[model samples]
Target: MAKVRLSAAAWGLSAVAAGTLVVGCSVSVNTGHAKPKILKDKLGDTVATRLAATTGQPKPDVTCPEDLVGEAGTTTRCTLTTGDGSTLGVTVTVTSVDGDNVNFHIKADETATPAAN
Candidate 1:
């Protein structure tokens, strides 16, 4: 996992609460024959839940174009669309994989893309 430095305010978290935010989730993966993948919807839901919990806002809508491979260094871009149709870019990266669990990190863009007229 690469070192990431962001102030708590960046994530809408207080210094104390930020410490409690574990940015990863454990999703079941089949380890047998093929590379495991985190389903797109599941990944989006996980991201939405985490963001909502940290920001004290309703869960935002998230959409990913494809599944994320369950391998360290794997990354996928997802979009968080606001009520006004402005979009925030979210980058999700796989940090590590342990048998059935795929741990990942999430980072939201610093600014939102304004809604189109």
Candidate 2:
């Protein structure tokens, strides 16, 4: 049988690595915050639908964060990517929440997209 020896520096590094492997690990569960019923994705979809209906044009692409912790009455601005690969601003407001029904408002702002050469 052969005996193995480790230097002091090697022993210290091994200990640190072992400690990191053991104590530096953690588990994070993202249940999300207890937010209002109105979320950004649904709100964006609503905006797209309403805009299409009001303008009689095709529904533009609407994108929002996957998670939005909204208050009962709060307004936030989200970006809207149109069919032309240009971005616009859409303001969203969560007006109220009644029972299981949630109410919100969306206003599309007309900001011209710069010409791409």
In TM-score terms, which candidate is top? 1
Global lDDT of each candidate: 0.67, 0.49
| Candidate 1 residue lDDT tens string, 31-88 | 3435667788988998777766775656667798888888899999998776666777
RMSD of each: 8.6, 23.5
Number of the top-ranking candidate, with lDDT as the measure: 1
lDDT, candidate 2, equals: 0.49
**TM-score, per-candidate, Cα-based:** 0.72, 0.57
lDDT string, candidate 2, 9-111, tens digits: 4333433333333222221222233544545577566665655555444565667664333445666776656434456555666555544445555655544
Model 2 pairs in collision: none
RMSD of 1: 8.6
Clashes of 1: 0
lDDT of 1: 0.67
Number of backbone-clashing residue pairs for each candidate, in the order shown: 0, 0
What are the runs in model 2 whose C-alpha is more than 4 Å off?
A: 1-35, 66-70, 115-117
Model 1 spans > 4 angstroms off: 1-34
Question: By summed lDDT, which 10 consecutive residues of candidate 2 come out lowest?
Answer: 22-31
